[model samples]
Target chain A: MTDKQRENLKNRIAVVAAWGVALIFFFPIFWMVLTSFKTEGQAIAVPPLLVFEPTLENYIEIQERTNYVKFAWNSVITSFGGTAVALLIAIPSAYAMAFNPTHRTKDILMWMLSTKMLPAVGVLMPIYFLAQKAGLFDTKLVLVIIYAMVNLPIVMLILFNYFREIPKEILEASRMDGTSTYNEIRQIVMPLAWGGIASTALLSIILCWNEAFWSIVLTTTEASTLTAFVASFQAPEGLFWAKVSAVSTLACAPIVIFGWLAQKQLVQGLTFGAVK
Target chain B: MNRTLVRLLQAPSIILLLLWMIVPLSMTLYFSTIRYNLLYPEREGFIGLENYRFFWTDAAFFPALMNTLVLVGSVLIITVVLGLAISVLIDRPFRGRGIVRVMLISPFFIMPTVSALVWKNMMMDPTTGLFAAMWNAMGWQPIEWLQDMPLFSIILMVSWQWTPFAILIFMTSLQSQDQEQKEAATLDGAGFWSQFYNLTLPHMARPISIVILIQMIFHLSIFAEIFVTTSGGPGVQSTNLTYLIYIQSQQAFDVGVASAGGVFAIILANIVAIFLIRAVGKTLTV
Candidate 1:
């Protein structure tokens, strides 16, 4: 083959390989989506059908049997609620630490991170008992608070990294202009760091949305999120593969789309800026 | 400029985190040393390390510890190795790269419970699952995944969900790499493997460590997958320490023993945490 033809061949091979790898990585999700459209019998059939008449029966049955919308709504409210509170608590402190660093700042940040490292189960019983005693068990409010606390260290660290990137001269110039710290933040820092703040919120929201452990432990039915709702299908006797797949697809769809959009921020935020 | 104002701005977060950390943890520590079974509240009293002794002596404790380590270790190795290969493969631009990236990263967004259930019933079920179907198509008996190799099964599901994370981080780090060095190495007649070893691997050290540490923290407490799929069962074969503690407190209603197990988990986590904090701390300062 000529050199030009060999180059073309190599590019084609790369394209094919990339597609093959992507497809394999994506196969389980595709299978779940496909299974969601299959009839119950086809869903669990030996030599599962790749070419079957698609049906909406599973979706319809799931809707009739359980309040899928309710669980989804709870997920939305708690995740957003948690992200908002986390940002509110995290931003100011992050700003202070980033711009007005003290000798103890690093220690304090490390301490906060250590708190996150404390395994959740270590505190599970007390939190559970306390929630019951306070009559706050299985409430969205409690979940929101716990989620915020759970995500606070991450939010603060990411926001701190973002705020640190804002050129110091901008803040210094404002200070020389006799602008107050509050005005400095409101007028300049917030606007400049807006993208980072937004990304922090998005990342935390996704984390909260997919958080399973605390949600399953803390909420039984009244305030169950999509994670807990999906776990409810763990009943071993049921042959409701299609219905479960439908619920699984529904539970993961919105966040997966959101995750794709926020992939860049997710990398930066999740690694605590270690990668970037 | 008053430093008090800066301290004030930071105090709310500090105080809240302090309370959140101190209250429950101290309570857990307190409970660990005493007898506090929910089923026998009247029998509650200071037991002085007896709960810890009971937890340590249990046959499942050592297995659970081993399982936790194996699960974390296997997943770490799988994700890092695969992530490195895939990141390098896609590092050079290819057709439809954006869509390919999305496809690759989709699994990380899946809820653990959903992923577990999907793997258990739809994919791994030997009777009529996808793997079974594939095996039967090829005229082979399907491997019973959860029944025979429960821990490995859980490891596989968790690894699938997290490999995307490692890929994302490694891919991002690769974008910021020094291309001149790679070009120079190529000019020096170094092959792809040599270039990767001398140029890419060293450059990716920080990200690789970050991925391993972060994934370790999450994997150490893996619960929902076990809860949904194996229930850490077939006689504690798949039981990690986290699941064991869940069984102790939630099922057996022995809060004291569970708390003791929790303390053990705390220590295990701290051993990892100290190293992570130091590594990350160095990065932050620099």
Candidate 2:
């Protein structure tokens, strides 16, 4: 056999092995989605049924029983709402930092990041007490505000990096034409940096959606996101297998789809350009 | 834009972050020094270091601390090692590799509570679980994972979620590697193992540390998984610092001691954060 045959054979082996690893890594999720389609009894079958009559009974049952829509709506609202708020606050902040650098700019950026380092557990009590006092506890607005704050630093950083990528000449030229700051942002910055902002928003939304620590601890039923909703399954029973799987599937599907779409850009957003 | 206008644009974020950082944190410090309870809000007074001492001396403190260390340490090792191996396996061009990468990274996007519950109910449940069925198929008894090894169970769940993160980071780093050198090495009779040890490992050094540090900051405070799967117990076996603090604040309703626990957590996290921030700081430009 020639060397080409040997190399092609090796590549085939690698692809097969890679597929095996991928399947193993992905099995639990595949199992969860599969179980979501199973009836409760089928979900917990003695041998864990691989081939069964698929059903939407579990999904229907979850919605009827727990109003899964409410929790999912809350998740949707908070994730999108939080991203909107973070972007509103971060866009200008990042815009300034990107265009108008000073000696303190890096220090200011570092200081903002240091805020992220403050452990959430450390700050949970005060926030909890304060929220209760302010009558904001377990409200979607509170979740939105808190999520915005928690993700503000990274969102700003990602935007800052993206904003910096827009050539300084365009903004300066706009300034010379007497375009106001607001218009400059709305016209020059937003249009030019649309891709970055979208990805940053995607990144922020994903973070807010999967934020278990705050969502789990800070909220109960009225404001509970899907993370909190699923935590209700903590002490679940065998009967809950299909329901929990259904809820879990619904909870993660949107973000996972969004993540796969944003998969390429998220690396730079997540690492804050550090990995490159 | 004038500097003043620029400052105005920047003010909201800086101020928001400032208040976010300082307000609750200072309150936590104050709460730690005082005697306070949620149930007895009317009776509060400065107790100096008593709350700290009480929190430190709690029966579960040492075990929770050890559990925190073990959980973080073991998860890091598992994710990093497995992540390296998996990334290398999938590194060479393969058919449908994009889909493979997407599948592998899907777990990272799953919320912790969901992942934990799925693992607990469908994957780890002794009799009705997938693992049990597999165990039975092989003629063995299924271990009660969350019951018998709660900490390990939590570690496994977290590693499953985070290994994708490590893989993603490593894969991006691997893309930039000098393939010409690899080909040169290959022609020089260098085997895959030697190439990996010398080329890939050295190339991945920076990203590996970034993975470890970032994962450390995250794993140190893992809560939802333990909360959902084990509730930090079958005993206090799976309880970590964050859960211990959660119990103190939410369950035990001991605000003073919980604040102290929070302070301990803050201190512990900052020790890691100082290093991580320095690493992240390098990327910032004025």
Candidate 3:
């Protein structure tokens, strides 16, 4: 083939290959969505029914069988609640790390990171006991606190990077040094770092929603998020596959939409700024 | 005013972390050395090293450790390799590239329980699963996934979730690849494979390492998938350290043994974190 002809051929092959991988990767989700529209019998039908009358029965049954709204509200409240608290705690420290730049800043940052490195299960028992002893077990407040603590390192790191990106000369020229730290952070740093702060919030919210171990262990009925509620199904018997699929779809739908909108931020935040 | 609006407002976080680093961990240390069980709170005493011994000698301990290694290692290899290929495939302009990219990355956002369940029920279930149908359509017996290869099943579940993460990172970095070098290599008769090896692969080195380290940190602690899919069963076939510890604490209520297991997890995670932080630190310092 001529060079131009060969290039066109290669392009065609790449398009086919990309679409193929994408569809295969995405098939489980599509199946879950499709299966949600089928009856339980049809869901587990041998030779897997390709075409069927889609039904809203599963969704309605799922809502009745489990308190779907309660679980969803828990997820929303905990994830957003946790992110807000994390930001509140992280902003000033990140501010110091970014602009103040003490000799010990690097060590402090590293030390903060090491705390995260301490696996959640390592401290699971003590935290569990403390929560119960303090009457915080199975409470949304308790989840909020734990999620904030777990996500603190990442939140601080992202905010610090964003804060650091604010031009130093602008800070000096604005005479923000004379202002109180809170006002300066409020007026100056917050506005300049809005994009980073937003993406950081998005990233943390997703993490909290997807968080499993802590949510499952720490909360039982009253405060359990969608993740914990969904874990209750755990392949019990052979029935409820349709209901399980429906619940899974509903639990993940909002976050999945949010995740798609935040893909660019996910790369930046998740890579810890390692990738450009 | 300046020094610590950062430090002052930061005190709660810093101090909480400091306390987190010191207090509860030291409590865990104390608990590890003592005999404490949530079941028998009244029976408490100093039992230095006994809990550690009991946990070490548990039947499932070693198998769980091995399962952890196999799962993390396989997932890391799969994600990096597939992530690189998929990213490169979609890197150049193509029809519906954005939509394809979105579809590929959607799994990462799925909660672990949801993905594991979806896979367990929809895809991997032997009789009723789609894989069963596919195999039967081809005139073969469907393999029981969770029963036959529990660890492999968990690996598949996790790899699906994470391959997207690696792709997102690798694909983003790939876009910034120096095109002039590719053109130069092309003019010198370098085909796609050679350019991929010499140029694209070399460019992806840092991202590959970053993906591995970061994925390792999370993979090492994988819990929910195993919890939902197999509960470390058909035996301890799929149990990893995290789930094993969960069983000890929550199931058995043996806090002391669980605490010892916790110490092991902490030490293991710290080893990985040193490399991860170093990688992150290098990027930051630059």
Candidate 4:
């Protein structure tokens, strides 16, 4: 066979292999969704009958057992609230670092990124103490603050990259036209970099939505996010696979749908400044 | 008013981040040096270096450290190698490429808690999980995954969630590969493997390092998966450093020991960060 035929055959094999791997990766999620509709017996069946009669009994039972709407509402409030607060802080910080970068700018950026590596357990005691002392424990405000701090680094990093992509010439031109720094940023910079900022916000919201460690530790029943809600499914009477799957499905649905809708933008934002 | 107002606008964020870092860290440092235990809430006082000494002497310390290294190292290697292969395969145009890409990347976005629970219940559960069902269908006994090999199970769950991230980075990097280099290599009779090794690998080095560094930082603090699935169980066999700290603080109520462990974790992470920054700086121009 010629080289061209060999290349074509190789490409075909590669594509087939890639598809197989993708399916394997996606199969667990498919199984979880499938199990959510199965009866308790069917969910834990020995042979795991693939052709079982699907039912919504698990969903109904989960709803009856737990306040699904309350948990969902808490998730929405905390995730969006955290994202808003983070953006409010990160925008100015990123703006300062991007446009008026001083000698300490890189260090500041690195410091913020390093904060992410600090294990939540490290500060669990102090934060927990502070929360209790201040009566902020299990409150939405506490979650909002913690989530903002947790996701601040990624937000700042992404926005800094976005702002850097907006040429310095544009900002300089706006300044030449007598636009104030605030006006230049609001009118010229933000409008030009709106796509990047929006995507960064979306990514931050997703991160905050998915954050489990602090949500589980810092909150109980009051302001628990979806992660805490799902974790509460762990009961003393052994594991409830069917009901847990139902809860898990509900918990992950919003972010998964958001991901599906904004996949292109999400991908772009995650890979921001990664390649170049 | 201009300079004062500018500083005023920035003060809240700067102060917040400063306090956020300093307060917890200083508390951890103070707690590390003292003989503090939450269970005996009133028995707190300075015992300089005692807590650190205890942590160093503890048998679980080295094992926890090694487990952390093993977890991070194994996941980084597995994800990068698999990710590169998958990314390269999907780099070329193919039918249903977009769907395949989405399917692969979707796992990364799944909440870590849900991912862990799904793996534990549906895929890794010995009796009724998919693996067990498959084994039963083949007339074989089911292998207990988390029960028998807890660390491996945790590693598997984490790798499943994070490999997608590596693939995303690799795919983005692959898109920027120079077609001219490949054409020239082909003209010079370079085979596919040779071209990939010589040209593609060199181009992908920076992204590979970035993925490894980022994964190391995150994976070192892996908590939710271990917490949700096993709770560092089967006698702390799967207990990485973070889990060990959690057990120390929450279960044992030994704040000093936990804080000491936290300091150790901080130092370890900083070491990794320093190496990563130096390595990436050597390769990355901007």
Candidate 5:
């Protein structure tokens, strides 16, 4: 082959390889979605039916039996509520650190990030007991508070990074015009950094929505989020693969879409601005 | 603006974090030193270091620790290496690249319990699982993945979920890489391997470290995968420290001992966290 043809061949091979890897990585999720539409026998068939008559029976049955909406609503409440509360607290704090950082600001930021390193299990007992005593066990309020606290550092850090990018001269300009601090934030900072704020909120909501460790540990029925709801299928006789897949699909669908949208902020939020 | 006012604005997060850190942690410490089993409430008393001794001496402790180390180490190696290769593959534009990126990252967004369940039921179930069917098609006996090789199975599930995270980071970082530098090196007669080794790797050092550090923090307390699939069973073979502590508190109802285990987990996480803070802290100042 000529050199030009050889380059063409290499490009074709790379494209094929990329597609193959993506398909393979995505196969399990595809299989789960596919399985959710299959009949029970089809779901467990020896060859595992990739081609079958899709059904909504599993979805209906799951909703009827487990009250899927309740769990989903619980997830919605906790995640959104948590994001709102976290933003409420994180915004101003991040504003202060970003615009008027002191010598100890970096230390304070790092210290907050370090709080995330404290394993949930370390404080699991106390939180559980405290919640129980306060009549807050298995309640949406408690989960919301905990989730907010858990994600507060990340929310703060992302907002701080975003706020820091706003030119100080703008804030200075607003200040020189006799704009109050609240108005400066409300008008100048908020408008300037809304994209970052939205992305931070999006990322926090995703984390809260998908958080499994605390969701499973801290709640059972009343405030059981989708993570806990899906986990409830872990029992031996609960091996109805079709129904489980349906529930899992529902639990995963919203966040997966949102996650794709917010993928840009994911690295920064996850790494605590360590990378970018 | 006064420094006091800045401090006032920052107080909520700082104070909340301080209370969140100090209160439960101190309670855990207090519980660790006392005999505070909920099952035997009568046995509550000061037992300095006794819970620690028992926890250290438990038969499951060492295996769980080893499993934790192996799981974290193996997943890190697999995800980072594979993620780099995949990122490099898709770094250059191609047909359907956006869809490919979306498909690859979907796994990372799946809730852990859901992914674990999907893997356990549909992918790894030896008899009815896809792996089994593939094995049988190849004229080989199917392996009981979670039954025979539980820890490895857990490692595979976690790596699958996290590889996309590595890809996302590396791919994002790759976009920032200097194409001009690569071209200059190529003009200097540097082969692709040498260019990658001498230039690409050096540029990616910080991102690679970030991936490692962040993955370490998340992987150390991995709970749901184990909880859903194996429950740290088949004779504690797959139990990690987190699972072990879970069993201690939730199953055995030994608060003191579990608190001791919690303390150990804190210490281990802190070791990694200190390194992480130093690495990331450098970037913060810049």
Candidate 6:
């Protein structure tokens, strides 16, 4: 074959291979959606039937049997609440670190990141006991607090990077004009770094929404998020394939949709500082 | 007023994090040395390393430790290698690439618990899952995934969720690669594989390390997937250190033993963190 033909063949092969990998990655999600429309018997049938009359029974049963709205509400409340609180704390901290040079700033940032490495299980006992003692167990407020703390490192780091990108000249110019620190941050920094702050807030909300470890263990009923709701399907007496898929689909749908819409910003935020 | 107010504004966050870290960690250290089983509340007392001894001697301890390593190692290897390949392929311009990228990255956004449940019930179920369905259609026996090989199944599920993360990082790094070098290599008659091995691989070393370290940190604490899918499973086949601690404290109500186990996990994670920071730091300084 000519060199041109060889190049064409290689490109074709690459495309085909990419398609195959994509299919493998996507199969589980496709299967979940497919199973959600099957009956319990069809779901668990030996030799697993692929072609069957699809039904909405699982979805109907899910809504009727479980309080889907309540779990979703808990998720929204905790995720948004946590993100709001984290942003409140992180913005000022990141602003200080980015603009104010201190010998301890890098150490503080590293310390915060290191704290994230400490296993949540290591601290689970004390948190559990404290929650019980404080009457904060299974409350959205507790989840909000924990989620904010848990995700604080990444929030601070991302916001710090964003803050660093803004030209110091603008802040210095404001300083020369005798602008107060509050007005400087409020009017200048916030407006300039709006994109970064928004993306950081979105990323934190996603993390809080998907947090399973604490949501499952700390909350029983009142504060149980969608994660706990889906986990409750794992009964000791054999798996409920159809119903579980239905519940899983329901739990993941909102975040999945939100993630799809915010794909560009999410990817950028996640890869922050890596490329640089 | 200006400087004082600015300093005051940063105090709350600093104080909150300090409290968040110190209070729980000190409490854990206190619990580790005491006899504090929730079931036998009246039996509480200072045990003086007895719980640590029991935890260290338990048959499950070694297995859980090894399982934790295996889970982190396997997921990191698979995700990084596969992520590199996929990211490179999709990094170039192509028709419909945007849609494909969205689909590929979608799995990373799904909640761990939901992903585990979906995999367990709809994709890996021995009797009626998609894998079983496809196998049966092809005249093959359906393998019980989670039951037969619980750790492997959880590894696969976790890997599926996280590979996109590695891909995202790799793709970002790939975009920053110098185009002139690739063009020059092409002119020099270097084969694609040779150029990639010599150029692309070198460019990706830092990102590859970051991906490995980040994934290891997250994977070591994997609880949602295992809990939802197998609940530590048919035996203790799938119980990693985190799940082991969970069962001990939550199910068995052995708070002292669980606290000791938690300390063990912390030490292991710290070792990984130190090594990772040193490695990443060397690259950054270079």
Chain A TM-score for predicted structure 6: 0.92
| Per-residue lDDT over B76-163 for candidate 6, one digit per residue giving the tens place of the 0 to 100 score | 8889888998999887777777777777877998899889877887788777677888888889988999989999999899989999
What DockQ do you compute for every candidate structure? 0.75, 0.82, 0.75, 0.55, 0.79, 0.58
Docking class for model 4 is: medium
Tens digits of per-residue lDDT, candidate 4, B223-249, equal 889888888768768889988888888
Residue pairs whose backbone atoms clash in candidate 4: none
The collision pairs in model 2 are: none
Model 1 CA deviation exceeding 4 Å by range? A1-14
The digit string of per-residue lDDT tens for model 3 on B42-89 reads 988999899999999999999999999999999999999999989988
The estimated TM-scores of all candidates read 0.97, 0.97, 0.97, 0.94, 0.98, 0.95
List residue ranges in candidate 5 displaced over 4 A. Answer: none
lDDT of 2 by residue, A63-92 (tens): 787878998899899999999999999988
Please estimate how well model 6 matches the true structure, expressed as its whole-model Cα lDDT.
Answer: 0.84
Task: Report residue A270 deviation for candidate 2 (angstroms).
Answer: 1.9
lDDT (Cα, 0-100) at A204 in candidate 4? 81
**Ranking of models by DockQ:** 2, 5, 1, 3, 6, 4
Q: Is the docking of candidate 3 incorrect, acceptable, medium or high quality?
A: medium
lDDT per residue for candidate 1 within A1-276, as digits (tens), equals 996797688768777887888898899999999999999888877678899999999899888888998999999999999999999999989998998898899899989988999999888899999999999899998899999999999899889889989999988888999998779889999999999999899999999999998899999989999999999889887758999999999889989998998989998778766667
lDDT of 3 at A81: 98
Residue-level lDDT tens digits of model 5 in B201-223: 99999999989988999999999
| Fold similarity of candidate 2's chain A to the true chain A, as a TM-score | 0.95
lDDT (Cα, 0-100) at A247 in candidate 4: 86
DockQ score, prediction 2: 0.82
iRMSD in angstroms, per model: 1.4, 1.1, 1.6, 2.9, 1.2, 2.9
Least accurate 10 contiguous residues by lDDT in model 5 chain A: A267-276
Q: What is the DockQ of candidate 4?
A: 0.55
Candidate 3 backbone collisions, by pair = B4-B7
